[model samples]
Target: MKIFLLTEAGKNIGSGHITRCIALSQAFIEKGLYPYFVINGDNSVKDLFKDKKYIIFNWLEERKRLFNLIKTSDIVIIDSYLADNTLYKGISENAKLCVYIDDNKRIDYPKGILVNGGIYSLKLKYPKKRNLIYLLGFQYTILRKEFWYVGKKKVKKNIKDVMITFGGADTKNITTKVLRLLTNEFPNFNKKVVIGKWFRNFNLIKKQKDERTEFIEWADANKMKELMMKSDIVVSAGGQALFEFAQVGLPVIIIAANDKNQLKNINEWKKTGFIEYAGLWKDKNLENSLLNKINFVNNYNTRLQMSYNGKRILKKNGSLNVVSKILQELTNKE
Candidate 1:
């Protein structure tokens, strides 16, 4: 079967959609199906599955190309939240089967299946007659094969290495504010800052070359996971990085830097005591909540509980499996 996967990747969009789609793509390959990615250009994900089948197009001008790809494709998988009515209509009409991976509740998904592979996504309800396959909740979150294979070592044996990853770039330099707060607290701890190449304030982060921290830029997938596995504490965004942390059993602080959406997720995670959040765009009580979590990171019980919670959510790497089932059903539907 020929599958066309539509996703956006890069500095502007972040890597969650593309990364998860690739994981599903791998499963398709394992089953001897041909999966070709139709992505928006210039992203770390482009290099990740470099040898895999793909054709990049500009998101703004891909309607013609999209319908054309859909015509030739036996199946079309969409992972873009920003895809509007026009785009969705065209792709759904042309492809024999169209599977959409979505999280937002606002979209009108009148055709095909809407797969939401996150825990919070469960709250989103869909219309009954739309032929939708809502794969809601973390039970379907996707992670690459490496995350699944990266063995978890004992916490005590792991170095006191802390990882700071905000979306490949915080257009707002939220990383700077986070680093400022964390540097003083963990003065002697081994720290690494992932400064994304596509980051808007690349120069500012590059200048943060100090003795207390290791600076990594445009890092490869292997190295990124290595640091995540080795780290004792992680201050990261609530996107794909969360899955990596969950896979390796690392204690983390969710940084809802980019938008309010991450903040909503952070609050939900907080209720479970799994991870702590530090919203970059704070109003008044920034010092209290932010520092408190940093302090909690040092406590034994808090850290252990967080690690255990990571494992609880870890069972959800069913993205590949779930998508495969959905596709099989969609193809057999009529």
Candidate 2:
């Protein structure tokens, strides 16, 4: 079977869509299927599709080119928030089967498989449609292979090690603000900050670097897993990073990125006791919220329970499970 992934990634758009699609692509490869990516990303986004078979086109000027790829492929999987209803309908008409990967219902789906693989996927309301196969909640969450089976995290009594990550693009530049606040509070502690492939404020972040601070650039899934495993607590953005950190049983303080859906996810995670919500990055009182949450998560018992809660909530082989379902659907039609 041939799978064509219709997605986009960049500094301004963030990499969550492309990253999750890559997880699904890996799963397709493991099943002896060919997956081709159809992207509209720029040069900076090319690194994300390093070894994968992909073709790029200007979606605005040359979107007609995608219909050819969709027509040839057995399945068309879309993970783009920027795509409109007309784009999805066009692809759906051409492809044999259409699968829409969604975090938020940002757009009207094109009547196929709709996967909302997040913490509160079960709670979100969807439009009524019989043709849509709903793969709701964490069971279908797409995670990298490194996060599939991770060692349990050991929470330290005194927050010795900290990992600060705000998604792949981090367009809001939360990493710098977070580091500034955290280092002042606990300068001696081991602090690791992830500078994404698209992050523009490298000099600002580099200026904050000291003996205790380490800045990692362009960290792949394996590298991210390594960092998550070593840290006692993580101050991260609410996206795919949440699932990865949760899989590794690391306690996290979530700062919602630009999306309202992210804020919804963070609040839901807070209720589960797996994470403490530090409000939106754009909030005026974000500094105060981060400070309080940092101090709150310092306790050993609190971090320990947070670790356990995260693991318990996200206990599933997400990528593998989603692939199995997709493959099963493909074979059943044959």
By lDDT, who's the top model here? Answer: 2
For residue 116, give model 2's deviation from the true position in Å: 1.0
Candidate 1 vs. true structure, TM-score = 0.90
Kindly report which residue pairs in candidate 2 clash with one another.
none
> Which residue ranges in model 1 land beyond 4 Å of their true spot?
42-46, 157-159, 282-288
Please state the error at residue 294 of candidate 2 in Å: 1.3
How well is each residue in 1-334 modelled by candidate 2, as lDDT tens digits?
A: 6788888888788788888888888777777876888887887777677787888776645767777656777888888877888888888888778899988777878767888788778877888788778888878988877777888666777888899888777778889889888777778888988888788888887777778998888889889988988899999887878888888889998888866667777778888889998888889999999999989988888988898988887767878888888777777767
Q: List candidate 2 stretches off by more than 4 Å.
A: none
- Tens digits of per-residue lDDT, candidate 1, 1-334, equal 6788888878777666776787888777667776888888674556767688887777547677667667966778888867887778788888877888776665677577777665567665666764766666777777776676667546753336778887655665767766666666666767788877567776666554457878787666688788877778888777767767877778877756646466556666776666777655554665456778777678777677778888767664575667677667766865
Which candidate leads the pack in TM-score?
2
